[model samples]
Target: MRSEAASPILAFHEELASDIRTGLAGPGQKMIPSRYLYDDLGSALFDAISFLPEYGLTRADERILRTHARDIVGRLPGPITVAELGSGSGRKTRWILEAIARRGSTTYYPIDISRAALTRCALELGQLPSVRVEPIERDYLRGLSEVAARRGKSDRLLLLFLGSTIGNFEPAQARDFIREVGERLKPGDGFLLGTDLLKPVPTLLAAYDDPLGVTAAFNLNLLMHLNRDLDADFDPGSFAHEARWSAAERRIEMHLVVRRAHTVTIRGLDMRIRFEERETIWTESSYKVEREDTARLAKHGGFDCLSQWVDREWPFAESLLLRR
Candidate 1:
């Protein structure tokens, strides 16, 4: 068991305790924070999810980056800082960094929660000529805030928040997050956002509930983490993974359904959690955004849509937002 006080990433264990205990033991529907789903194993599982044939998100975004890397880099002025939020693995970011290098040497800040991921990204990116990769080991907003404080007004920037990660936040949360980010960024700074657009229900569903079962493993890994950290007795095998589209909400929700009524105790939290047969613990929501919706969201976030790139086949987009 890792000590929460010792590990920066695991420091949120207390917060996880409160959320899971309250969410599982509270009234009505139960819920858990999707953020907790990214343990080392979960992160690896997600990487596998990216490669699954049914999952077109990674491929779609890569296509955009490959096709328009130069065009995207052209929008931002040189002697700039390229900061990426949640830059896990930094595979797609290689495209942008290559483009940035063509213009000139610039500072690269890759912010991510997993220090392991950040280290790997830095090592790979630092090898690029004239480019310095400094990674901030922190969450999204906090990392951006830190960058804003140190950077000067004259510093040009191109902030990248790719991977349709914004889709994870609820609409209101997304709006607030983007707005806060905009306040920290100066005018003329560019925000590149990759969003999974509203597509056919079947395609969206398949992406989350892939036939390869990678998504299922990813969903179940959350329980494994909870059991390990919280001293909870959770039989991950006893839970069934489920992914479905909430048409009204325009999002796909993933859940772990109880296979049988049972009680489990988290010794660390000193709580006994009970689940009725068929009860579900809602885990994640990926909200799909339309092009018009993305434009409106940028406006709410104090940005104007400068350009938008859509995948040729899939209804996925990479939109450039300029802070106004």
Candidate 2:
């Protein structure tokens, strides 16, 4: 089993060792962890892709948050502390913090894996008098362990799981993530969840695999991350980004395919890997959820959906739930 105590330094060391052995030695292929895709450059590229017309998930989810933030925040019914999981750019989170502050004084908590991103968001959010931005640099999977260590107030916790990050995982994984949130939250606490609703399969596919090929570049950026972080010779030009819709899974899948047969080396790991032409490395999968499915997941994890709202234009949802 993987040790939870593996700090980023240890993780980096393991990656370096693996890369040196496999990345530089010879041509072999393996899946790269999607977690590395958000280094500064990749995060900025993702922000750009979010603005593209083809990517409607971000905008649609933002609209739901903007339109219903007040209603959702109003449901809290008491002084609240807001916690956001997987907060990327921290754009939409600002709206929620403000909304909750207006209703009652608020203390904002933004949890992310990126320390730099957290600091940037913390500095920007500090301006609001009601917003006390505590940046927690840890994976959301750990939930409140580190967060609880930092926060002693023990106030009612409200979660902001926005931008359809919930879709990034499969059903079981999503349930587990929510259950972790439930475990950390008190009975009166709430979990505000965001999800992309089921839509036309073509629409879903196009969102990840766009016509202008921006999505392609976004998908292939994984190789750039691997090369930079793991000291591996991953030629970005050698991978053609591919996206496919999995009917059984009801999600859009993103992959980076080897452009041609090749070998690469990672010096630290002393490993070499081979790739057949067109062999693909899967990167991400975003699952679409219906209201019933979303509610079921939340309820089974020890919460009941209080209210759910959808965007007027596209099928996206923001659900507010209270611990059961």
Candidate 3:
């Protein structure tokens, strides 16, 4: 984990100790933490999902950012530093970073929990003439304090939160996070935030459960990681991947279901576990936010909303928020 990602991510990791213990002692105990979903291979697979036709979130979002990046930079007043959360693969980030550098005076600070992703992106980004890469190896939540501390008196900041990753946080947590981030900026600073919006259950389901079955393979990758890293015996083939849309939360939840009664061993912890058929492990939640809810959260975060741009069909929305 990036040391800078924050205490909350560590808190979650510690919390997992309790969950992992509970999960092993009894049948149908607790769900696995979502953070474990990105074990190198999971990271690469998710990056591939960005290109899949069914997952239109990434492409549509990039379109808006690419179209209006100059406008966003212009509206920011001048000479801003660009800081991003979850700056994965540095694909869309290149646009905003380059835009800031085009002005001849700007810096890019990218914070991600993955050191490998950060190191690779930083190496590539360092090649730019006017760009200086301040790569942060920390979870976004824990690293927010350092982000606030790094701000200078004369700086205007542009915060990039693309990829709809914001959708992963629960509403209350999302509200708290946005508010905290807003408190760290100046009046002219802005957030170019991307979010996946409400959609048909089928459309949403397909995005998570692609025809290629790559998503399933992605979820099971976690089990493989645990076996390799934690010295656990998880028969990846014995479990099935499940993805479903939760209408109440308006999100997609991924689960891993044990297909048959089984026993497994954790060599690191010297523990044994038994699973029954149909036993499931919750892995991730991807929430789709309504416009009003998003705007209200932004307002509470001390931002005056400037604009919200959705796709041609309104499947997603990218909002431009100026700090108040």
Candidate 4:
């Protein structure tokens, strides 16, 4: 029984180690999967980032949900099941759930790779009347698949991909991910997508690289996560957090720029990696989109844009799409 319980943890560590090895040893720019940046500490730091004055994405998302929660919920049929991808703490989700619960009982499946986030989500959302919170501690797509399987044949699902998290993917990858999601849903099901709009380069840079340094702390925490989880001797202080806006790519990139060359040993993986001065490990990329692009993305994902609400204050979009 103990072994059975420990298997998942063992598998997670193995997968993490494998990804780190592949990412660090790969040709061209070394990179780490952005998902790894959301362990407990990383998630908490990100929650702090959302509150930073310079970071307005989270606020923009909440604003849309708060303003149009009922309108968005009204668009969907009753007896609906709600599922959210990467639902950190599910604080913004209250608006939608409250709106839904006012009509009928709701079963919310909040999926995330971070257990800490899921725990908080379950606790925070479980208190709502007529709402049942079922937290899924898994990556987005797989968790959504499980939700689909558990759903009744005629059930209408409202799948939410909020916080502009889709921006983490490259354009093509984003399309592929949405298509995969569409494959798991039935016709008439709905999708609520949040996307950050193209703004001034300075604003974009400020959101990712805030002057308060919360964003930097969030970026640097990824190294600390690796050090603790992988038994690695990474000098977090040796690498500085840097954010760059790529005009051509229409994205903001975060990287850890190594200050000096050094070698680090990963005792867990039984491997040693050498770093060169000025070389960087690309950590994350956040893509910004135009309003029209939301419709295009929905169409490519086998969804039709039903409606879109834009937040004027921060220039963010919340698009509602229905499966074709």
Candidate 5:
């Protein structure tokens, strides 16, 4: 369910095909890669989702950054490099950058998969004095690897993976991913990780399956992306958005449930994907973390949890992990 090809668009198409072929045509009922939900329109829809009152993860993380900006920045060495993975729109990032810039001039690396988003962030950050922005247009790991490879041995780097993006990965994968990040770090470097905490199921359900339907638009937009790029016939209207909390997994799952049996044709892959009535395509998972588990994972990944700042009201946490 992957592709090694280099062309961005081709690789994207191939990956989409592989996932569909594996998920839909194979053992699984159906599933789509959540990452593919970031096409231009999808990105914009997410920006809208962030603004929704029900979707408080963004605001909660922003509050934590604003309240503890200095403390968060102070934990890091001064005149350091701030690297942010999946730097969307650069709104929440400005809080971190401003805090860092107040101490001294700092380099900002905003990494993202969208070239347009990267360009926007770079242009916006460039306007800020005392901050030099170099945006990396690639997925988080590859971009982080490039930044890690280019760093000097004596560099002080504080990597930021905010907005509970870590929640997207399952537990074991989350640990392994954090370990990969730790492997890239030298002692004295730090990682600022934002994680959503387990909360009432009602709150969780509202955030994903919003009353405003913006989240639904964000989820269904994935179909539009495929329809446009892969030449697939997906009547988005035929699917309903669903958000369910899996208590055992401590995650909220987003799915698109087919209302009727139909076949989706992808011209690029020369494949037709059939779906059964009521079949669901699992789209994304947002995993909430326990405070103790976050600390344990940091230690397991070769880092010490230096500090944690939480907005107890929303129950969001921003933990600072230092490489050891």
Candidate 6:
């Protein structure tokens, strides 16, 4: 059963079908928007991926939030309203919300593309005594804008972009995204940004392509997602998940490589695509950054870095930035 929410899912059937047709029929590398990877099953698979031993990103994020949530909240002025972009599961959000709730009542807006994710987030965080859980089922920017519109004159907005989801964007896109986020904020509003730091190639590779193949399953599930949602005939077995590190881009790329040549049809779109053996459909990219990069990113977004907490064990950074 689909759960109800204030905001409807933005990626409706027509928009999704259009995106799929454009991405698959494009001249360059065949691809699908990484956002499509988070259908109900994909979101659950990702939750599982976070628990894999090799994937320490989520643990690192939780550690930083737990240790510094108070300090992060303290840096902001009174009457803070929390809004988190891509608030998956939102299990790690307890630290920040608890910190805010300690002071007084607050409203928490968890914006996500997946209805299932928003539903789960509401269930997980709705129990906070002083925090009201409001789930918005929309893409990041649009959802943030809606939150911005609802902000009270005296409420300080603390935008949480945790889980290193920003790494999924290209460098330029990331900067632009941050800047756009700042546009929706008044001076003194806060932005908590999470970024995975640059680490050894082997460690990074292992994190994306875990030994137990949970990550592989997570990546492969995208095809299953498309098949189920779009009435597409994608052979999940015809392709293998591949994770590669791009030295120049400083990013880990997830791809679905075709194992054998075949043609797949999207009955809904009435389109057919021919896949050549070894051909790859680029799915997602996660760009690792240096410690200093966080501050630079904050500055680029018209925000000042108030504080940055690093997790030594995993080399992850949670930077607190103030809109300027």
Number of the top-ranking candidate, with lDDT as the measure? 4
Would you list the C-alpha lDDT of every candidate in the order shown?
0.88, 0.77, 0.79, 0.91, 0.86, 0.90
lDDT for each residue of candidate 4 in 109-141, tens digit (9 for 90 to 100): 998878898999998899999999988877787
Query: Can you give the lDDT of residue 179 in candidate 2?
Result: 84
Reference-based lDDT, residue 5, model 5: 34
> In model 2, what lDDT does residue 297 have?
93
Alpha-carbon RMSD to native, per candidate = 2.4, 4.0, 3.2, 1.4, 2.9, 2.2
What TM-score would every model get versus the actual structure?
0.94, 0.89, 0.88, 0.97, 0.94, 0.95
lDDT of 5: 0.86
Off by over 4 Å in 6: 1-11
Q: For model 1, how does the per-residue alpha-carbon lDDT over 209-320 read when each residue is reduced to its tens digit?
A: 9887899999999999998988888999789999989999999999999999999888888888788999999999999988999999999999999999999878799999
Output the worst ten-in-a-row residue range by lDDT, candidate 5.
Answer: 1-10
Question: Model 5: per-residue lDDT, tens digit, 106-177?
Answer: 888898877778788888888888999888767778789988976656669999998988999988998999
lDDT-superior candidate, 1 or 3? 1
Which stretches in model 3 have alpha-carbon errors above 4 Å? 1-29, 183-188, 267-271
Clashes of 1: 0
Q: Residue 72, candidate 4: how far off, in angstroms?
A: 0.6
RMSD of 4: 1.4
Write model 3 residue lDDT over 1-324, tens digit each, in one string: 666445655664555556677655755544776667775677778888888888888888888778777767777766788888878667777777777778876777888766677787888887877988887766675555567777666887788888788888777888888988887777878898888888888888888888998888889998887787668989999998899788877889998989999998877667788788898888888998777777887898999888887777537887889998
- Highest TM-score model number: 4
- Give me the runs in candidate 5 sitting further than 4 Å from their true place: 1-13
- TM-score between candidate 2 and the true structure: 0.89
Query: Tens-digit lDDT track for model 6 on 185-234?
Result: 99999999999999999999999998898888888999988888778899
